[model samples]
Every structure is written in C-alpha cells, then in structure tokens.
Target: NNFIPFYFFVDVYHEGLQYYVIRSIGGNLILLLPVGLLFPLLFKKLNNVKRILLTGFFISLFIELAQLSISVYIRSVYRSFDVDDLILNTLGTVIGYWLFFILSMFYKRVTYRFKSNTSINIE
Candidate 1:
C-alpha cells in the first residue's frame, strides 16, 4: 500500500527508527543481489545490464503483488506493497551486475596474462 517511493525512508528518518530503515532498505536491496550475479552467469541471454534491470524490476513487482494478494486473501496486512522496494531492488541488481562485470574482466585479464606467459614454442 506504500506507493510513494522513499516514503518509508523519510518516515524512518523523522521518527529515528534506524532499525526499520536498515531492515527495510537493506533487506530489499540484498534480496535480489544474487539474482543479478547469477542470472547472467547462468543464462547466456542475460549477459547485459539492460536484461538484468528488466528482470529485477519484474521479479520485484511480482513479489510485491504476491504480498498484496496474500494480505487481501487473509484479511490482514501481512505485508504492504512499496514502490521503493522495486527501486532499491533494481538498483541492487545493477550493482550486482557491475560487480560480476568487474570480476569477469579481472579474471579474463589474469588468465590471458598467464596463458601468454606459459606459451610453449614447438621445435
């Protein structure tokens, strides 16, 4: 039910609820970090940042919608939908993608250097 993005951040800041801020923001961001790192590595088609972004957005949207559905079905607000979660989750995915990219680059550079150094000449 929290459609306003970053609203929780403002509320938590004003109320000095540091724990909620960390739990909500950090939890959402960390939730999808693995998705970003693994999707591209596992699927050749997801080897780009754009694909990661869209995938993250849709995944987060589905989670939020599911929560809303469960809350309605149970006649209780077990979890509320929040746009900020979508934003933060997507950001986390992008960050993960960048980390993967950097690591891949470093790996390639190291392997290439090792191969060149270990080249054997045929007589």
Candidate 2:
C-alpha cells in the first residue's frame, strides 16, 4: 500500500453506535450556542443582532477557558487541553447557522400552508 505511515486513520477501541452518536451529538450541542443565539435575532422579534453576536463570541471564549477546568474537575484522566478544538467548535456553530437557514425555508412553507388551511370559513 502507498499510504503514508504517519497518516494512519483513527483506530477505535469503542464499539457500538450509541457511544459514537452520543459523543458526536454532545460536541455538536455544546457548539450550538451561536446559532441558538442567532435564531431570536433573525425571527423572534427580540434580541438584537449585536447582542446575539457578542454573546456567541463570549460564550465560545468562555468554553475555551472552561476546557482546562473541565479537564481538571470533571474528568481528571480523560482529556487534554486543545485550542484547536475550541476553534473547530466555534466554527461548527457557524455552520449550524447555515443549516438553520436552510431548515427554516421548509418551516416557512409548512407554516404558511397550515395557517391558510385553518383560516378558511366553514360557511
């Protein structure tokens, strides 16, 4: 095989999809703050964009700070501190905002249909 010896793919010790998905989803949910903050700014008729964007920035900052404490206090033997993870996590929230935009188009269509159907007079 011509594959680079130093570039080996991940070798897993954990088995079963439950562990797989839980880890994946937990990280995603942790990173969802920016979009969560943005939703109200875009559609809730509340929360100005500046406040939401500031909140997202500070939250990501705080998470990076907490990773050290979390490693020490939450799991002493399980994790290492990494700034790259913080960057990736914040980036994931941004990507999720785009996903939210895509989903809302479907939501808008469905809600319009439902509202139109329900507003008809029975007479």
Q: List the residue pairs that clash in candidate 2.
A: none
TM-scores for candidates 1 onward, in order: 0.94, 0.46
lDDT of 1 by residue, 1-123 (tens): 889888879987889888888888888888898888889999989899999999999999999999999999999999988899989999889888888899899999999999999999999
Top candidate when judged by TM-score against the true structure: 1
lDDT of 1: 0.90
Model 2 poorest 10 in a row by lDDT: 1-10
For residues 11-105, write the lDDT of model 2, one tens digit per residue. Answer: 22133446654564457456754564466547664244454444455666676567667777876744444444444455555555556556667
The lDDT of each candidate is 0.90, 0.54
| Model 1, residue pairs in steric clash | 1-81
Give the Å shift of residue 2 in candidate 2. 30
